[model samples]
Target: MSCFENIAVEDIQSCINAEVPSGISEVNMNYAVHADIATFPVPLAIGAVGYTYAKANVIEEDIAFTAGKGFGKIKVQVNTGELTFDGVGSVGNMKQKSSLSFFIPSNDAQLLGFIRTRLNTPMVFAVPERQGQNRLLGDKFNPAYISEVKGTTGKTGEDDKGVQFTVSSFAIPLIYNGVIQEPAIIP
Candidate 1:
């Protein structure tokens, strides 16, 4: 008696209601060729996010050191200061060294060429995270820089995103204007 028995009205309603599902809207980067740190980042190829993909790897290492001069009172001291291993921390092992690396897709030729040309220059990257209801939830933008471009490559493997890339966002800064991944934000 039913022509479309598999179709449900609630499923249809749910799909229609789920507008802001938190998808990768856009990811773009710009570089300054042999430019000073004070210089603003110029768009590499303007607004182009064709087949865009981006990733960042953040590494945080623990800090540890020894603080004490000589083995004992009789040992005496040759150096003025205590023998200590230089590490990141004010007091004890309470600091971590953090660094970031990104894997970006070479979607546009002009942008890829810019990256190749300025492979050794300081660059600023602006990445925007937008959703359908970003207007209500307050979208966030992640900005970072690479002091020196360490590696460059182009490869195609059996399993790759059109081409080879590398990076994973870990210990990366995420300044949330409001709670993002929540039931209400996406709903």
Candidate 2:
């Protein structure tokens, strides 16, 4: 029997009359060690929504945070934040590589030093979009790591000066349907 024969088939088209917006409005980041998140949703192969991956649309449970621990919020500027996915190999050995990139408008020494410590830390991020469902970028099984951090203080006064971070993972982003909580920070 052919491998295709065992796969479920269904319509995978989107709504033609619906409108979709663009851009991420906010990012909620937290250390993976301080939280527990559910795995990505998987399609039920033998169910009626098998081909459509209905259950993969949204996660219903919230991420469990350690006592007194919560996500750190970052407000993204227009056109400054985005998520990209690249397939690393062909179908037989394919892997989904997802990356989240965002710019921080500040380049303070203290903040720079704090971010520097995250080089080896695994993290999970929640990206809230302008007009769509919130997206969760990493989980316990497939955590995200800060691959790059670039801090710049531009020469010209009009030029942008800030830090850009690139977070990478081996999983696809999923719709998050839980409340995002952030702890108060003492200044």
Q: Number of backbone collisions per candidate, in order?
A: 1, 0
Top candidate, metric TM-score: 2
Q: Model 2, 1-187: lDDT tens per residue?
A: 6645655566788988888877777544433432333333432333333444556445667776655556676655457888887889788889878899988888887677768766777777888776867777775467788888988898899988888889888877777787775654522
Candidate 1 backbone collisions, by pair = 56-168
Among all windows of 10 consecutive residues in model 1, the one with the lowest summed lDDT is: 69-78
Name the regions of candidate 2 deviating beyond 4 angstroms. 1-7, 27-52, 184-187
lDDT (0 to 1) per candidate: 0.26, 0.69
Best by lDDT: 2
How far in Å is the alpha carbon of 45 misplaced in model 1?
35
- Across residues 1-187, which tens digit of lDDT does each residue of candidate 1 receive? 5543433333223455675634322332222112222222122122233211121121122111122211101111112111011235577445323233333333356545544654443322222234421111100122223333322343545422212221111123322222112111210
When summed lDDT is taken over every stretch of 10 residues in candidate 2, the lowest stretch is: 34-43
